[model samples]
Every structure is written in C-alpha cells, then in structure tokens.
Target: MKMNPITLIIVLVFLYPILKGFLFKFSSRDLKCDIDDLSRNISFIIAIISGTYFGKKIFIQHDDGIYRNIYNHIPQQILDYLENNNLIIYAIVIPIIVFIIYRVIKLILDLLNYVTTYPALDSIEKFLSSKGNIFKRTTGMIFQIPKGLCYVLLVAFALNIMSVLNVSSKLNGYLEGSKPYKSICKSIIMPVTNSNIAKKLPNILNNSFRIVIREADSGRQIEPNSDTPATLNQTNGRKTVVYYNGVTLDQGVKSDPQIDKLAVALGSEGTNTTEKAQMLYNWIGTNISYDHDKANKVLNNDFNVRSGAISAFETRKGICFDYSCLYVAMARTNNIKVRLVTGEGFNGISWVSHAWNQVYIPESGKWINVDTTFYKGGNYFDNPRFSIDHKDAQIAGQW
Candidate 1:
C-alpha cells in the first residue's frame, strides 16, 4: 500500500509542489518544457479534493468498521495478519489513480498542440531538426513516456489482483471489541495529592494544547520539544509505575487519575485534558533528570524496561526513551490517547534513534506528537503541531 493511489494523496497534497523547484539542479542544459502546466494543475486539484473527501470515507471510517466486524468473527492472529494486508491497500490506490489521470491529461494536451500546429516541414526545418547528439539525448527521455505508463498500469493491475486474494479477513472469533487502548491505564499512585496540583492539571493541559497549535502553523520540520536523553528514571518490573510516576488518585499502579478528583477539579465529567497535559510536561521538565546508564540495557530483554520516557520518570532521569514513555503513561492516566513513537533524532553531532509520543486530538481527529525530553530541557516549543511517523500508534492495553 505504500505506493497506493489514494494513500499518496497525503504526500501529493503536502510535498509534490516543492519538487519542481529542484528540477533545474538535474542538468545545466537548457530544455524546452513539454508539460501542459494548466492541465497538470487542474488534475492535481481534482485529485486532492477527491482523494481527501472520498479517501477519508474509506481509510478513516470504513476500514474501522471492517476491523470491528473482523474482530468479532476472527482470531487475534488472523486479525493481525489481515491488518498487515490491509496496510497494503492504504499504501497503493490513490497514488496510481492520481498519476494515471495527471499523465493521461498531460499527454493528451501535448499531443493536441502537436496535431494542431503541425510544424511546417521544409528543407530549412529539416536542417534545423538535424538534431545534435545532445538534443537526441534530451528528447529520448520524453519519448519514454508511453513506456512509463505501461509499467505503471502493469503494477496497478498486479496489485489489484494480489489485494483481493491476499487481504482476507477470517471468522475465527478469536478477537473482541475494540477499546480506545491509549486511554486505558494500569497503575495508581498518589503524587502527594496536592489539591493545588489537581486544580492546576487542567489549566496546564489547556496551555499545552497550544504546543500542538504552534506545531501546525510552523513548518512540519519544526517539531515540539523532543529529547535525545531523558532526565526521568527507569522502571522496575512494573509497567504502570513509569506511566503514572506522579501521584495516583486511584489504587491502580497505572497513571490513571481518579475520575472523581478530575471531575471535581473540572466540575464536569471530562477533565481539561490540555491543561493536565501541559502541567505534566512542565512538572517532568522541572522535577526530573536524565539517567543514561540505565539505558545501556537492551529493550528486548525487558518489555517493561523503563530506560526511555517511562523509566526516566521512575528514576528521575532517563534518555529520550524515559521522557517519552512516561509522558505516554501519565497522559493516558488523564484519558489521553498517547502513542509512543520510535525513530531517530538529528542533533548536529550524531544521529541517534529515539522514542517520542503522539496524542490523539479528537477536535482535529488526528494524532499530534509531544516530546517531553525537549520540554524538560527548556526547548519550550509551545503549541506543537503533530504528525505521525506512521499511523496507529500502539499501546500496552494498560495505557
């Protein structure tokens, strides 16, 4: 699905235009442009609008419905298998369609002009056409356009056949109803239970919501506060302990806060998620320190390893892993959908793979990244905009 027609809409809408500027860098030779710019733009516009409105109908909602039905009818292993196949669908469709439509129109327009103009043929014209070796080389690439289309269609046809047969769901009844996994929590600890802290959490989360907003307005490259190393602690065998490093209003070791306390603070059934998140971000940055020594242990050895964000908060110091994991854990305690993201960071000195978090914002119907380690270090990228390295951030059922 990585090369799918519909899935490519995201890339097309966001990044394609920038590539044209780089074309001149490919060669110093002067070349006449053959593209029908108007039709190309029109095709791009149509593709974007159609892909957005129609693509969402399938990718955003219908797929979820299919998954729900499959979960009821299939086994977990089968469901997992189908999910992988389903990804293939998302990665393929829109891109092929967009390319086909755009190219077909461009080809038609270019041919129409050639037919209408019918450049006069004469001895002088022939002499001018005695193409130099350089002109032949340049023209050769353009002649390959039809060949390109055949290859594209071949790929699309083969994928379509593979999809129907391979994207199969089962009816084994091995799975169950889907819960918002990111919001579930397992630990319950009290962080000295400051009435003031309870009161302040909502306000803090609200402020932190601004971090997401800023991220949106700024270019995608300018990320919110992220971390290379964490100042929080590592975890013991417990998973809930790291996520809920602070006080727990509930008896659970997970970071889930007491609904009653939250309700009392907010004066409503829902807590001020934005404010609480902000406060947690602020608290972790100011209260903790990063401990890199614990990170020396490999993650596979301990699924519950607190070396990252989770562990850092527990030990009061960690590398990026601790800060991010703890944020994911604690944020979930407040009923926030925090996803742990594993990737690398660019810090000018060296490149290191790192972990961060993404929280789903219902208001935007999207997941936004939140990096606690950077905030802890005072980078303070407020109201950060969010995008995923990939879709569907996973969770440990325990939030």
Candidate 2:
C-alpha cells in the first residue's frame, strides 16, 4: 500500500505518548511524571505534526502547480514570498522560535518577581496576577514545545531524505503488474511492421493500465473526458520550421546549468546528429522509466507538465511529455534540431495519447522519429515508418 503522509502523521502522534511514557519510567529523575505534563507533551507534539503536515502539503501543492486553486484567495506578493522561501524549514523552525519567545517572556517575568518591591514591578506583577495564571501556564508549556518540535524536525528531515532517495519508486516496482489484466487488447494498425513491436504486443495487452489512454498523448484519438494537452502549437509545417518551432516552444527545458552542461558532455563526443541523438536516447531510455504513480495521477487529472525536463531528469521518472521534454532539452542544448511531438502512439498494447520526438538529421535531410520513452536499443528510433505507431502527431506549442 502507498504510505499515506496523513497516516504517518497520525501514527507519529499516537506513538509519541508511548515513547514518552517509556522514557519517563527509565529516566524518572531527568523528567517530570505528572499527568498534566504528559497531556501538554501530547498536545505539543500533535500541534507540531499538524503544522508540519499542512506546511508540507502547501509546499507540495505549489510544486504540483495547484497553487492556482488558492491564488485568488491569497495576495500575489504573499504567494510569491512563500514560493521563494522554503516552507518546510519555516514549519520546523517557527515552533522553536515561539518557544524562544516564551522563554524571553518568562525571563522578564522572573526579573519582575525579583524586584516586586519596586512600584513599577509591583504594578506589573499585580496586572499579571489578575490574569489568573494564563501567562504562567502559557510560558510553562514552552519547555516541552522545543522538545516536541525537535522530534518533528527529525521525522521531517528523515522523510525528506527518504523521498529524495525515491523509496516510493522501489515500493512501486514491487507492486507493478500485481493487479490482473483489466484493459481489453484492441488490434491497432501497426504503422510499421517491425518484429520488435510485434514481440512486445502480448505484454501490452496483458498489462492493465490504471488510467489507460488518458495518461499519455494519442496522435489523433478524440479526448472525450480529459484535461487539455499541456502544450499547444500555432503553425504546422514539414521543413525545418516545424523543428525550429518545436525548439521555440521549449523555454525552460534546460534551464538548469548542471543539466545543460550534462547534455553538452554527453553529446560532445558525437561527430554527427545521428550519433548525438543516439547517445541522448540511450541515456534517457537507460536512465528513466515510465512512472506508474504519475500515470495514475494523470488519469485522475492531478499531473502538470510545467517543469518538464528539469523535473524529469532530477526525478528520473515521468510520463511521455516528461521523457520527450528531456530529450528535446538535451538535443536542443547540443544544437541538434528536435521537435516535441504530441499525439497517439501505441504502447505495445493500446494506442494512447502520447508524446515523442522527431530529430532532424542534417546529413539525410530528414526528420527521424524517436520515442525515448520507449527506448530499447534504438528499436523506436529512426524507423522509416515511425508514423505507423505515432499517429495524430503534431508539434507542442500553439497557444
């Protein structure tokens, strides 16, 4: 089962009290053993967890491109500030800062108590006393707040590291294909009669897709109930314009200097367009994989294509758009003409809306179709009749 972050938060909340009780038993001298103190500990931990959860969720929300949902509600400047700052750090540090403020207040109260004979100090003490120990209880809870916050920080840090390592990807690999075949295998018109495509047909038919055609681009299949394509194109052409326009559509594909440099290093050895394209195709196909979780999210209308290559290269998992975008990014960075194509393509089983690419070979004066997402030893690269599988294909930016 997927590890629900919400469930983890709840587990942590419940687990804290037991751990605290165990520690209290063993370290009675170091810790207090009052029921009220235990209650305060539990409350503080719960608060920290709640704060962390919502904070992380908001951070993810912005990353996932769903901030538009709250864009109107929040001022743009505040949203911009949140986007610029790391919410996760703030989430962990804010409570500790509050604890520090409490400590400062308590120190001032202590100084006032010591000088109670002074008229000003006496007046302040009387004012505080009239408030009926509210300040006392509030400041008293400060000591435990930092402890609870420290625990929260440790858990958050560990979780962040685990996410970076993509523990979820390992877990997903085990669960893939566990479910029975669910999609009916439809006979697709094989545009190219390649034996390799034939060999993979059975696997596609038996493999049940959770989101099916909705997840990937189809060359020309009518999308009846799906979100609009992430990219658009204004003009269509058959020559270098088509390829150049595709390059134009790619704005931030290789925005990262690191990835830009990696692209250069990978393709620098290639003496020609074909060799460079092959190197990039091999790198992507060998490195990346079809993200099932992301596909499921796309099926549920929860995926975005704004980050493109940077996200795909960093995460090493994405759907067709991601794969195509990275290839386009790398290829263009090396000064090779490439176009990001969107349409329906067969995935060994069914024809789905997909994204692939066409790289212009200067020597041959032709645009060779390349499906880096389905890269298998150049099987899907430069096939003379690639249009057979990649139908309804067009360049990505129109709108």
Candidate 3:
C-alpha cells in the first residue's frame, strides 16, 4: 500500500513521545522532574493558543488607528512600505509579543514554584519512590500524553499560519492530503483560534479589485429630490454639468484636455443627450480592451486608482472601475449628467464586484443605466433586465 508523506510525518509526530513514555525506564526522581516539565508545557500550550487568538482580534480592531499614528511620524515611502506589507508584519510581530508576555508570566511562576512547590514535591517524590517501580513508571507515562499533544498543537498552529499566508501550493496540497492534520485542525485548532478570520484574510487583502472605486461621503445611494432636475448645466463660456443629486461632474471625475477634446468631437455627432451618451459609450467599447495585467495588480492591492481615468484614456485598456471612471470624465466634459455606480454583477458563474455608469437624458427626464465593461458581451445600455444581473447598486460618485 502507498503511504502519503505528510500523513506519515503527522503520525510520527503524534507517536514519538508515546513510544518514549512506554519504552523509557525512569526513577521516581526523574518522574518528579517530568511532572515539572509537564506543568511548564501545559502553561506554554495555553499561552500560545489563547495569546494568538486575542492578539489577532486586537490587531484587527486597532490596525487602522495604529497605521494612522505611524503615518503622521513616518516618511511617505516608509509608510507606503508598511501599508503594503502590514499583514506579514502582523503575523511576525504578534507571535513575538505573545511569546514575550508568556516568558514574563513563566518567570514569575518559576520563582513561586522554587520557593513553595519544590520542597513539597521533594517529600511527595520520596513517598512515590517507596510505592513501587510500577506506580512510578505508570504515572510518568501518563504525563507524556499531554507533552505529545502540546507538540501536535504547535505543528497545527504552524500549518494554520502557512495556510493563511498561502505560502506554497505544494505545501498546501501536502497539508490537505494529511488526514491527521485535517482532523487536528478541524477538532482542536480551529475552535481555539477562531479560524474564520484566517480563512478570510486573503480575500480581505485582495479586496482592492472588488471595491475598485473609492466611495464618497458615507457612500450611500440617496434618491434625487423632486426639485432637482435630471440634468443641470451652468454656462458662462465654460460648461459645468451636474447630476440629479446636485453633485458636480468635475468633483470626483478627473479631467484631461485630450479626453475633453475627444468627448466634444463625439458629442458633436449626436445632437441629443441620449445619442451623445451612446456615441461616447460605443467609442469606448470599440477602442478600449480589458487590461488583465492591471487586473492582477489590483487583486494584489498594488494598483493606484488616482490616475485611473487618464491611464485608461491613454492606454485604451482598463478594468470595470477604469471604464466607469473614463466614461464619467468624458460624459461630463460633453455636458452630460452622469454617475458612477458600484455593485455586484453576475458573470454567468458568480456575482462579483463591478462598476458601471448612469446617464440622464434631458428629453426623457430620467437617468438610464449603462455598462461599457460588458459592451462586448451584449447590449448593456439602459437594458430593461439590467437589474436581474446587477445587484446592490450604490452611488459611489455622481457627476
């Protein structure tokens, strides 16, 4: 029969101390020493397990506050480095802090044991020594069980860390293949450590791709007031466009002279609000391609969204956020009232975080939904069934 290497390793780890307990010959004095070692091992196990749980909880709760304090004192480059690698820093630093605290408590306990427990244990050891070899040996073997379990817990903790970090696919495969490891994690480690946070860490870290556009104010979608028009334009030589919610187009949307020029040229062909919006949308859908490289970086939380509109304009490539940002910029420049909406969209498999836009038609006096990102897929321009796929719509910004 074939044997899995990881399963073999785990079995060996579990069996090593049990074999030692059964095989080894020990005097009563040695058993007394083993008792002391068992006490220390039990304390160490409690400290490691509980300390890790509370430390992670505390860090998650106060991480933003800690970062803010450091931000004011550190150089921008250094702060950026810290922000980018904060998860790794937390993983290393929290364990060290917990170990330090454990050591200090252990020192106090050791001092108390020397003054009080040792003298009493000496009398007890002498009594046990007189009992028999059988009694002394049996007691000593029983103590070794907890010692073995302590080592098992340590291995489980290390595996948990590696899994959370996504250290290696091969190592992860080995861990998954090990039945002993899986049972230990499920029955013991997960309950103690609150492993849900560990499971969610990767998704939380990679959420930049999900929440691509930054929210404004409280980021809640408010229905437009009856007094507010579908479109607003202020003209005194320079045209200013506003949404039905009264947010000016230029506020969140970054403006570029080239984008403005192109928008003007496109809008000049349409002669109406809906037609102009359609022309800009069609041009973007035809010219721009989805940037897979940028998507990867965004997933890693490495891409910056500050220059997203201008970058998409120049490269003619972007993700959903970029498409929405570019559309808002161009539409506003052509005096069309628009908004950038963020929500989840079904990609025929699962609903993923996505961004799209809404344009106000002056003639119809209503705002219409549009998704240029799905332009290649189908007709997403004010489609009646748009709500079926796009869910939990929120107005990230209006222009």
Candidate 4:
C-alpha cells in the first residue's frame, strides 16, 4: 500500500503527547504541576471552542443591529474601506480578539482554581503519584488522551473554518488529502456547524457589510415602446415589459441628460431597431475601456450598479456589469428594449461572474444576447456558441 504522508504526520502529532505522558517518569511535585497545567490547557480549549461557536451565533442573531450601529456612525469612505477589506480584517482581528478574550477568561479561571481547588487537586495528584510508577504513568496517559483529542479538535475546527471560507486553495487541498482531518471534519465539525443559522452566516456577513439603501420609487410610470407592439413574437408573445410585484423591469435603469443625448445621437444612424442596437453595441465595445481597478473593487464586494453605470457613461471605463448597465440605460433612451443579464462568463481561464445584455429586435421578433465586455476579443453579439461559455444566465432587470 502507498503510504499517505499527511495521514502519517497527523498520527504522529496526535500520539506524541500521549506517549510522552505514559513513558516520562515524574516526581509527585512535578506530576501535580503537570496536572495544574493540564487543567489550564483544558480551560483554554473550552474557551476557544465556545467562543467561536457562540460568537458566530450571536453575530448571526444581531447582525442587523450591528450593521445599523456601524452604518450610522462610520463615514462612507471608511465604511467602504472596511467592507472592501472585511475578509482580511475578520481573518486577523477576530482571532486576535478571541485569543485576548480567552486569555482574560483563563486568567480568571486560574485565579479561582488557585484559591478554591488547588488544595484538593494537590491531594488527588499526590495520591495518584503515590500509587507507584506504573499506576502514575497509566493515570497520566489516560488524562492526556482527552487533552490530545481537544488539541486535535481545535486544530481541525480552525482548518474547517478556513476551508469553508476558501481562504487558500493549496492549504485546503493538502488538508483534504489528510485522512484524519477529513474524518474529524465529517464526524465532529460538520455536525456542530451545519445548522441552518451557521449555514446562513456567510451571506449574513456579506449583506451586513455591504449595505445598500434604496429609496422609495417615485410614482412615475414606464412608457411602453411605441415602435414595437405591446407583445413580441419572442417569449411566446409575452408583454414587452416584465414585472415582479409592483416593480417594472426598467425600474433600476438610471439615466441622465448626457446619456439621453448620446443615445439619441448613436441610435439616429440606424434605420431599424436591430441596426440601432448593433450600432450602440459596437460603439460601447469600441469606446469603453474595461476598468480593472473597478473590477477588483467589485470582486471585493465594494460595488454599486447605479454608480457603476454612471461612472462608465461619464468615464467610458467599466467591468461587465457596468457595460450591461450602460447598455440598458442607453438602449432604453432610444426606446430599444433591453435587459441586463448576469451570470458566469468564461474568461479563457475560468468561468467568472459576468454581466451582459439581451436586446429585443422587433425586425427579427427575437431577443439576442450581446456582450460588449468581450468586444476587445471578438464578436460576442448573438454568438451561436454563447451558451458554451456563458451559463446560468438570468435576467437582472430590463429597460
């Protein structure tokens, strides 16, 4: 059989302390001190486990309150900075805070133990030591097993959390190959952290940090496109405007005087909706540069669609979402029906979260895909193999 190095390492690490406890002879005084040290170690272990478990639950329960407090007090720029770097902050600050809390708690417990339990424990330790070398060794080993297991459990729990957050792919891969890690995770960690509240924690944290406050909409109604019929031949002759609850598809589309004027000028060159849509697509792809900085900020969860579209229009730089948002606003200004679609797009290396547009052309009586973000690469406008790379495509909003 092939020897699994990771499993061997885990076994050795787990057994080392237990074996040491069993084999190493100690005087009564030393054994008593060791017992005190074991108690302290156990207290520290319990503090960490309980702190992590309960801290998560408390955060989940009161996330909204916490968010509101922070949102109200912090400046917007500082909030943005914090939200952008929340993962790093949590990774570093949370552990340090937990450790500090654990140390304080351990100090209190130690002081209490010294005052109340030291005499009794000393008597017990002396009695065990007096039972002869073999008995003393066996007792120490038996006591050491639970402490060793606690150490393993704590390490495994930390690894499980890092794995859940996908902190490092290389580290996670190594851990996955370790049989002991996998076994403990499956048997112990999963059971404790797989509850509904625990499962919702990531999303809760994300939402709490990235707070978006949308104002109530004005009562202005969306005017139906006069060029096309109320229903199109596509979508089985469904109405041109899609609605959810009382909200229309174009509700999120933002516009300004500059955008409106530019759209009119762009669309004026084409005779029909298809021609106009293509012209607009070509212009956006050729003119607008992809903003890599904004893309990185967005990946860190510091992005706003309204702001993105506005910035893209004014600056001619944006990522996929910005491209799609700009397209929707411009198309709507020209009375060209368009929808912002968001999903994964293959960027050669991997599938990434991407946004594009689908324009309804009355001439073809069909809605076609358009990805202006890929203009630098090639024609993505209604590409037949579009589905080959773009997947899980869902309409975000229409205009």
Per-candidate RMSD, Å: 18.5, 21.2, 19.3, 19.1
TM-score of 2: 0.41
Better of 1 and 4 by TM-score: 4
List, in order, the clash count of every candidate structure. 81, 17, 0, 0
- What local lDDT does model 4 show for residue 167? 58
Scanning candidate 2 in windows of ten residues, the lowest lDDT window is 180-189
Q: In model 3, which runs have C-alpha deviations exceeding 4 angstroms?
A: 26-28, 32-40, 63-81, 115-121, 197-399
Query: Per-residue lDDT tens digits of candidate 4, residues 1-399?
Result: 864654666677668668877897534455556656666666666665555545434332223566456445646775456445544433654466468767877788778767876666577676775578888777667756765776676667666656545556466456655778767755556445423312321111111111121222433334423242222322323323433112233443567899889889999999999889988899898889876665555547554433445667888876666677778888988999898876655432223456689999888899999988777655578765356446656666666
Off by over 4 Å in 2: 1-254, 304-307, 397-399
Per-residue lDDT, model 4, residue 9, is 61
lDDT of 2 by residue, 116-169 (tens): 524443354455455544453443344345455444444443343333233464
**Which lDDT tens digits does candidate 1 get at residues 125-162?**
35536656455444434433433333333333333333
Best by lDDT: 3
Q: Sorted by lDDT, highest first, which candidate order results?
A: 3, 4, 2, 1
- The digit string of per-residue lDDT tens for model 3 on 119-177 reads 77677667776677677666556757777777777777777667555566567557655
Give the distance in Å from residue 176's predicted Cα in candidate 1 to where it truly belongs: 45
Give the C-alpha miss distance for residue 55 in model 2, angstroms.
58
Candidate 1: C-alpha lDDT: 0.38
